[model samples]
Target: MTEARSNIAPVLRYAAMRRIRSFEERVGELFLRGQSAGSMLHLSIGEEAVVGMTDAMAPGDTFTTHHRGHGVFLARGADPARMMAEIAGKESGYCRGKGGSMHIADRALGHLGANAIVGGGIPHVVGAGLTYRNRRSGQISVAFFGDGAMSQGILYESMNMAALWHLPVIFCCINNQYGMGTRVDRSAGKLGFGGRAEAFGLIAAHAEGQEVEAVHHAARDLVAAARDGRPGFLEIDAYRFYGHARMDKSPYRSPEEEAEGRARDPLTTARARLAAEGLADAADLDRIDAAAAVEMDAALEADVAAAPPGLPTMFQDVYAPGTPAPRPQADRLRAVLSEAPR
Candidate 1:
């Protein structure tokens, strides 16, 4: 059960970024073919470095992510097949096909879940940090939220509590310039996101979200501090290649901005770095790309072949054991009428 030997740093980062890019492109194709379950699908195409931070985390560390978190989940070692199954609404999905893309969660990997609600999962990390402290587990909790969530009150509240209790939680904000087509300048005030966290008396770290190594270094430092019973904040200045959701074409963004964002593709940058450092050759990178394609193809095939959840199962996970759900309004009215004198 020995861990596999690691690849050179640049090559490792390139492979990880390639895998995510391939997986997400395939997902976009699936959605186009009407194979996915829900209307909401947020791809993390240009934000692979956020996932690279996974290299810095410990086994016991836990995290929650925003809706656009496929890369993070994959980086944290989630099975590609199960993830595709969840998006396809197959019975084999992580949530029995109930959670879909937005709520994929694997407790074994310490990935609590991805939240679709803006700033919904921020406080959950605080709760996890508090639990770790109480249980003396020495585990840190990380929360990944978008810049759009910066204005949410719950984020501030969570930071306040984490700082006050010296809880082990990290708030990693992916500032992708835009939050659902609205420029960050329009959404958040002039103050930087890290500054806001510092105002709450927590150590804040800032790093470029485009470079995998840079993100890993910063995350390593912040995670170490969190492990020692201190709360921290991280700001990653990145860009989103696509719009907010599947249907959005980013009409709000200018063509110049779009082109500029596209030019800074993280995968391309990582590949170039690997070559410049003589860490890997073109063939090596191609082999990595081929392997990722084969893996994703098999996963998508399994997801397509998997069965859908049964009707009885709909009510099973929704309620507590032996707790009856409320009767339908029509049924209740009929019962009341029958019992009355009329």
Candidate 2:
């Protein structure tokens, strides 16, 4: 625990983790209050350290994340207000509220997007890697997937291509132990995920995801290799304290198992270590947490008051303007508009 403090500034790492935890907790509260756009919500509550590795990434490096990605995006400096608005389905959101919880994307922040499908975003980083290489951008692309995605054939195919072509890509598998309700052991035949990437001729590493410094060191080395045109794989061992989705209670997991997972929460561990080492007092950490709460609460209020996208704008981003709409659809839209009181 003290080792991480030495590897990186404890204040910086702890602050980021606390902010992510606070942001996700507030989102959950807003969702339960029926302020969010969609009923489906996923949180990266116990896996803050998994995203803490991004501290090692350069600004030019891009990343694609899985559904439970608010922490990852937040760590990369995505505006909390806009992210909240997106979750609330406000027109002011990143994708004009269209992407919602599962598909938030901000190209300017180097966040390609968060994919809903288990393995949907894996290949995207490969494509970005190809683009970076072709442009000689000296940038790397990272793909963050879960243990569940390890079973998906698309992941393997993407890894093979990355290795064969020497693409600057890092395949980061956050092995949170459970994919939905099924434990990883029951799902993946092999416990070691790095071997899967090594089989495809890529440098592979396994690290403790709960320790921020451990993940950061591993990520830094892997990213350096990737920049040199060597693809790599990293499997970070962490656990999701909550169920897969917002409404799920994880009845499949025993009470003892759930308790055990919570005990190892990275936020709690980080705070304890910081306090013990005299790096930061409880008061300092609490102040950061309080500020995060205030920021997120205001964002939630604004998002709830924001307007939803108008029907006329449905196909605006989908297709180029001036393209003729289908006759039947155009007529229906006109009819609906005419019947409105306005």
Candidate 3:
């Protein structure tokens, strides 16, 4: 992909956003169909524009993502069918049905892993950055977390380390307004979020997800700078179109607030932008969306049809190879009975 947003066609950008939205909608459907592995699925429904940052990321760039990360991973070149299979806990998943929704990762794609903890994944990139700096690899690491991580001491520590060592890293906070029902304005004493990053001596910037092109352009500059040994931080303001999880009804926010937030949907905004600028027409965009829906529909079908790992493989990925595994209770009981009497 291009290292800059302008290098990519406008239709491609809209397609990326539309693809993400479509995949997430399938995720919701997966849950409703009871095929999802767990009830704790975190959807990036309204935060699809974060993929704009992936556009700025060059080959060999590494990143760790937050739990609400399916879209970013997809934009980074994940297979939707396998992704759905993983989330469904099917044997054909990326991790053989182990990582599930919150932990899908593809090392070959430079995704270290997705962390379920709020700020757990933030520091992994700092370590990767240090290695890149030592080897003169010219590669940068990015840590994608949510606004909920802004208060985490680990994030501050990681930022300070990255700045002090001049490590090539970017800590992007996806601020979707609410931190599990507590609004950002209520959770943090500081509002802009980027201001806090600036205090750590890192290059900081902010953008609205409602304008994905704007976010992409902002990221292009910062990503270039980060690759030059200067650390950077970005806080993208997005809205959580649904509750924090599949089961959350988001009772804390009013209908008026949710309506206003949903009105700024980036996917819709990008479609309008493409049409308004003559980069694409309504018919073209409709075809793009129709294709995305068909793609996701097939992915969901694959997920439902895929088989589970089954009991024989229960301990497969849980232990290291060439090491003895603990005996199952039934096996141990059989061994005891055989040795006790004749």
In lDDT terms, how accurate is model 3? Answer: 0.90
Q: In candidate 1, what are the lDDT values of residues 1-342, reduced to their tens digit? A: 012324476576677788888889888877998989977899988888886577788887899999988988888888888999899888998889999999999999999999999899999999999999898898999999889899899999999999999899999998887788898988866857888999999999887877887888888898988888889999888899998888999999888998899787777777777766667766777899999999998888888889999866766756777899655567789989999985
Clashing pairs for model 1 are none
lDDT string, candidate 3, 190-267, tens digits = 799888889999999898988888888889989988989899999899999999999999999999999999998998
List the lowest-lDDT window of 10 residues for candidate 2: 1-10
Clashes of each: 0, 0, 0
Better of 1 and 3 by lDDT: 3
Ordered from best to worst lDDT, the candidate numbers read 3, 2, 1
List lDDT for all candidates, in order. Answer: 0.86, 0.87, 0.90
Best model number under lDDT: 3
Per-model TM-score, in order, reads: 0.92, 0.92, 0.95
- Candidates 1 and 2 compared by lDDT, better number: 2
Clashing pairs in 3: none
Q: Which stretches of candidate 1 lie over 4 Å from their true place?
A: 1-9, 322-342
Which ranges in model 2 have alpha carbons more than 4 Å from their true place? 1-8, 322-342
